[model samples]
Target: MFCFQCEQTAMCSGCTGHAGVCGKTADTAKLQDELTGALIGLARSVDGNANRPTASTDEAMLAGLFTTITNVNFNNQTVQDMIDRILAEKRKLVPDCTTCGSPCSRNDDYDMNKVWNADADIRSLKSLILFGLRGMSAYAYHAMVLGYSDREVNDFFYRALFAVGYDYEMKDLLPLVLETGEANLKCMALLDKANTETYGTPVPTTVPLTVEKGPFIVITGHDLHDLKLLLEQTKGKGIHIYTHGEMLPAHAYPELKKYPHLKGNFGTAWQNQQKEFANIPAPILFTTNCLMPPKASYQDRVFTTEVVSFPNVQHIGEDKDFTPVIEKALELGGYKEDQPFTGINGGHEVTTGFGHGTVLSVADKVVAAVKAGQISHFFLVGGCDGAKPGRNYYTDFVKQTPKDSIILTLACGKYRFNDLDLGTVAGLPRIMDMGQCNDAYSAIQVAVALAQAFGCGVNELPLSFVLSWYEQKAVCILLTLLHLGIKNILLGPSLPAFISPNVLNYLVEHYKIAPISTPEADLKKLLAK
Candidate 1:
């Protein structure tokens, strides 16, 4: 099997052989590819057939794409089941495609191996589109769970899927590649709307890292609806709920935080799960990607839901019954006393919930600070965190920023220095935690608002984006920045392995995108601008 859809691909190239770097075996990787190919076929059937794709077809496509994302589903059986669902959906669309003597073959499942073996430039472009769609599907699926669906976002999935199967040149694929970002922008908006309308807008919230004694559950990944459901189920049962990883920001939402038993955050980032969750005394449920193959000691307590699946782990099914997880937590019984867990930086607690709404509400103050020279600059230092060596640059970068500058961060990457106590700037916390990775939407909103208030384009403002990426979600978010013509992004620990030299060069020349160097050097260059 060959895979290169993430930042941590083997040696910065495609991962091939028995297993991927993420612990995905060749069999699982092949199944994911097959599922993707089947989704493309399902998209073709929807394109050819008269009837619009059914709701089940929509869900199958979303789940199938999401499952293939790095570190999401490691279970071959579930991958095969998703592939069957896609094929079955396709059959419903073109019932006689196989039976007709004069088969058009327009709805055939496109073998992904063809893309893997295509010309380098074409391959890179298609990877962008495919990976971007995978990222968008996660956001789209989350919105869907909250009963919010956009026709434009849903239609783009079919359009992009069909294009992947089609033999397209670099010119043809490039536009679609950016269009993936365009669609994802709308997809993220739909999710933000879904989350705010359903849960109410997030506010500035400070969450402790201490886990209170007694029974407790740790919910990870980016799904708020899942957390809410689990909170409702475990309520009044003496089970305290703790946010982990991306779910760390769920504390900011009124609906979720209203739960009296909803306690503090646990763990640092997704990459440290093996070490962090290994000795935890409670069940940990993964609602999305970023599952590091659970260790033997904790695999029994790992519960997966939605598109996340692991072999032999307890899975909370669509019924959303979290009884098994709750029972596991009860059995473990948690720590004998309150566990005071600090972040990676050793701070007792970290703050979050500086989303677009929160930041924009103070737009006048921010503009005034900039005008008065009280604020030096704005740095958006956020993205996925990985076990890669060079990732420390983000910590150092945030550390070296001018005291007058405000650091706006999101996603798990912020865990690197979020607990550092950067103090305040312009009467605001220097390091402002913005929701999850999807909350890159919030960062964008704040940047656009700042630009507008300052009477300049986003790029012309005193802002710089120093981002780190780990998976396809980062790919789609990067594309969204490019779509908006945002420039001068500093991306590292390393560039994606799938990007061909030409594509990488194109990005550099067009977007002024560069790899992260030393924090001091990058800070100087950014400040000099």
Candidate 2:
């Protein structure tokens, strides 16, 4: 088994031989590859038959790609079931393929190893396209949950999947790589609209880390729809609901916050879950990605929904019945007293929300602050977090930023310093938690609004993005930034192994994308510029 779709691949290269660094065993890795291969075949069949993609086709495409995302699904049986569903869908698309005596390979399953072993440059470009689609699938899936679906976004998945299966030249694959970014931008926008419209625009809200004494449920991942369902189901049942990981931002939404039992945030970020959830008496419900394999102590208490599946963990089906999760929480009974928890920085509480609506509504004050020199710059330091020790760079970077500069962060990476007392710049909170990675859309909006108010291009604003990436979602978000022609972005915790020298050079020459260095040196460089 070989997989290199994430930033934490073995030895900074591909994961091969046995288990992956994420605890995905050889068998499970192979199954995920098989699932991906079958999805490609289904895409090819749908493309070959020129059949309009139905909801099932679109959903299968989303679920299949989402399942292969790092740390999402670690269950071999569930992955095999997804492959079976894809094969069934493909059979419907091309009924004659199986019986064809001299069948062409156009619609056959792709061997992922072929791409992994392809020319370095071609593989780099194809990897960009494939991984970008996987990242975009998460956003698309969220939108679909809110009864929003874009035909252009759905069709691009099949087109991109077909390209991944074929031996496309750099010239052939390069356009689709950028197209993936362009498509993902729209996909994210769709999700943003869906979320804001469904849950109301997020507002700045401070959340405590203290778990009140009672039976409680901790819901992780980026699925707000699932959280709402769980919150509704657990209401009147005396079960407290605490948001965890990306769900930390869910507390900022007015619709979700209204629940009396919807209490405070629990753990720090996804990377810390293993340690944080180890002896926790509360049952945790994972609605999306960033699910590390559960430890033995807490394995039975973890519940999965949507595409998140562990081998033996209980799963909530499409009916969205969360009775199993609620029951587990009841049995555990939580802490004997109101347990106080603090963030990594030892702050008793952390604040979130401050999304585009919140920030942009205060745009006038922000503009005035800049004009008066109360705020000198804006730094958007955000992305996925990982277990790599080097990720401490983000914590240090945020710590070292000048007080005159405001820091806006999103995704799990913010957990590194979200609890830090950055203090306020002008009248605005110095560190703004802009929801999850998908809320990069909100950050983009705020940046554009700032630039427009200042009558300058986005790059011309006093803004810099110091991003840390771990998985495909980061890949797609980075691509979207490039698609918008944003320049001088710094990415790190190490560059992707898939980005061949040529591709990296292209990025450097055109967009000035650079791997991060020391926080002191990077801050000096950005400030001096």
Candidate 3:
């Protein structure tokens, strides 16, 4: 098996051998590759047959792609089943091809090796587009669950898949790569609108770090819909729900947080689950990615749903029945007394929900501060947090930020310093937690607004992006930033292994992107500029 799809890949290169760094077995990896190939085939069929897919077909495409995302699915059986469903959907879409006498490559599955082994430059660019779409699909899937679907976003998935399987030149592939960013931008907006419309626009809310006594459930992943259903089902039960990882943003959603039983956020990012969840006398539910293989001690306590799966773990199906998890939580009996936990920075509470809508609602005050030069610099410290030790850079960087500077963060990475009491700058919270990775859209919106207010390009605004990436969602968000010509961004703890030298050079020269150095060095350079 060979996989280089995430930040913590073996030794900063591809993961080879029987198991990936994320604990994905060789069989599961191959099944994911097969699932991806089948999706490409379905896309080819869609290209040939212009009719729209049925509801099942549409959902299969989304789930298949989402399953192949890093840390999402670890069950080979489930992945192969998804591939079979994709083939079945293709047959439904192009039944005539099976009976046709003429030779047809349109229905044939694409060998991903063709793109994986192509010229280094082409491979890098295609990886960007493919991985970006994988991330975008996850967001689209979540929005779709809530009855929010965009024709443009769904249509682009097929178009992007078709391009991945084609023999296109750099000129052709490059534009589509950027279009992935462009399409993702719209997809994120649709999700934002979906979330805000369904659950009121997130307002600034403080979430506790303490885990209350009694039976509690720690919910991870990026799906609020699943969290909501569980919250509804667990209402009036002794079970308490604590947001974990990407689900931390759920605390900011008015509709979800209205449940008095919905407690504070539980651990840091997804990578620390092995240590964090160990011996925890409660069941955990994963709604999306960054699921590492559960340790033997915690295996029974981990529950999976949606596209996230691990062999042997109890899976809650679409019926959204969570009795198994609830039973486990009750059996565990939880802590005898409330356990007071603090974040890495030792603060007992963290705040989030300063999304674009909330932040923009207070735009007048922020603008006035900027005009008065009271708030000197703005740092958007955002992206996924991982197990890598170097990720401490984020915590330290946020720690070292001046009191007068504003720090904007999103995604799971913000957990590193979200608990730090950074105070406020000119009446604005020094550290503002945007929503999830897709909420990068909110940060971009705030930046654009600031740029317009200052009468300059976004690059000229007193804002800098220090991003840390882990999975494909971060890839798409990074591409979106590049598409907007945002420059001098600091990206780390390491660059992608899939980025060949030439492609890396192109990004460095064109975008002025650089790998992160020490927190002090980076802060100096950022301030010097």
Q: Pick the candidate with the highest TM-score.
A: 1
Model 2: C-alpha RMSD to truth? 1.2
TM-score of candidate 2 on Cα atoms, chains taken together: 0.98
Q: Taking the tens digit of each residue's C-alpha lDDT, what string does model 2 give over 51-100?
A: 66679878888989999999999898999999998998888788888999
lDDT of each: 0.92, 0.91, 0.90
In model 2, what is the error at residue 242, expressed in angstroms? 0.7
Worst 10 residues of 1 by lDDT: 46-55
In candidate 3, which residue ranges exceed 4 Å CA deviation? Answer: none
Best-to-worst order by lDDT is: 1, 2, 3
- Backbone clashes for every candidate come to 0, 0, 0
Question: Candidate 3, residue 131: CA error in Å?
Answer: 0.6
- lDDT winner between 1 and 2, please give it: 1
Error of 1 at 518 (Å): 0.6
lDDT of 2 at 414: 91
